[model samples]
Target: MAFASVPNGNNIRNEDKVNEFLQNKSKSMAKVYLYMGIGLLVTALVSLGVGALFAGLFSNFNRVDTAYIAENALVAYITTMVISFIVLLVDGVVIARRAYSSKRSLWVPYIIYAVTMGVFLSTFLIAGIDFYTIGEAFGISGLAFFAMALIGYKSKANLNVLGMVASGFLFCLLIGSLFWGIFYLISPTLVYIFDIVASFAIMAFIMVMVAVDTYNIKRILANGCEGNVVLYCAFIMYSDFIAVFIRILYLLSALKDK
Candidate 1:
């Protein structure tokens, strides 16, 4: 008589593990996206409300018709911005890292950072960038973000190498762009070229990072990272989205000029 084959115990256990991972995957992603979405909302509201007041006060300086006035104001503005950027970078890095250490850190510091960033973004009005262009860039950014994020989440390839390389490139690009930007008054023509190049470079870097970050977040959840780490991941994705959004804004501004 032929005996019925028994189910392999190891295979059954492995199958169960996969099902558990798939089930928990949705919940993990929901938590991350929820935090990121709220952060974006806060930033948007802050930028819009604060931007209006800033635009009115600085309207005379940003008038493109008067080269002398605009260039002078822009030089000073760039210098101030460089300083602000440094402070924001340092503060954001310091606070964001703490999310791993303290649960309370996931809330207040992140909000403060988002609000401050919004205030910084509002200063873009001094460059004569309109809300329409901002909105258009934001729309493009959202689309790109979702596409890359989806690809990253579904992909099985390890993106750790790409993430590391992209981080280095981003740091170098930041320094190069800021250094070049500070000289805009001296050579507007050259600055335009550098701006175009930098915009494209930054956009490419941000795209790769978005995919890498998304993949890593899913992988981390699979390995069972703590709840607070989920907030940190959201903060990272929030930063990636902002980077892409700001780069899109730059490209839009450049195209509009032409």
Candidate 2:
């Protein structure tokens, strides 16, 4: 994705301005990545701790009594997911009002969101995915994220148009999935297929979002926007990274089961 127009009408002919712009962009991007990394670390640690604490619940169930385990686990997972969703809503609100909110208020919701997500993600351990495979998926997700961010940073392409299109498509996908969930009992196999397709589609959408969001961040910085907006930017990128990681994990788990 390449655009012919230079952002902010930057004078590429002026050597000093060009250097200054590059330096500032680098510093801004570094902060974005640093915050994102911290968020990821927090999520990973909390997830691991939760998984360890609930190891007994996730293990040693007899195949003969599988029905009981499945029933209880499903209920627990669904409850956790609902709570996580609420946390996400609150987190979004915090991000939206971040400029006006105190630093403590902003940090509280962000931390809560990360911790809630970690608890939710620990449900994956119940699926019996080995640690090695889980680590591999994380590695792949990191590489994919880095590659997309680099492209977004270096590419001259305008992503505004693409972002709008992708957002619409994503909305449709969410609607379709909701309907699928409601009607899945009618055709479990077909719904499963759709779920797989939806997972991959979501992965692609989020990957594009990562690039678009990164480009937008750079554009904001280029325009001389300042303050604690970097926190909001990191939240956006961290969400993208987690989405991609979970999708890749789902794909890998599916393949492993096969």
Report backbone clashes per prediction: 0, 1
lDDT of each: 0.81, 0.78
Expressed as tens digits, the lDDT of each residue in 1-258 for candidate 2 is: 987975453455576777888888778778878878888888888888877755655453546566567557656767877978898787778767874444544566667777887887776775567899889999999999989888787779898777788889989988887787666878888898887888878888888888898888888778644446766777778888898989899899888789
**Global lDDT of model 2:** 0.78
lDDT of 1 by residue, 88-150 (tens): 787687766786675465677677768767767876765678879988998999999999999
Model 1 has an lDDT value of 0.81
Reference-based TM-score, model 1: 0.74
Name the top TM-score candidate: 2
Strongest candidate by lDDT:
1
In model 2, pairs of residues that clash are 3-157
Query: Which residue pairs collide, candidate 1?
Result: none
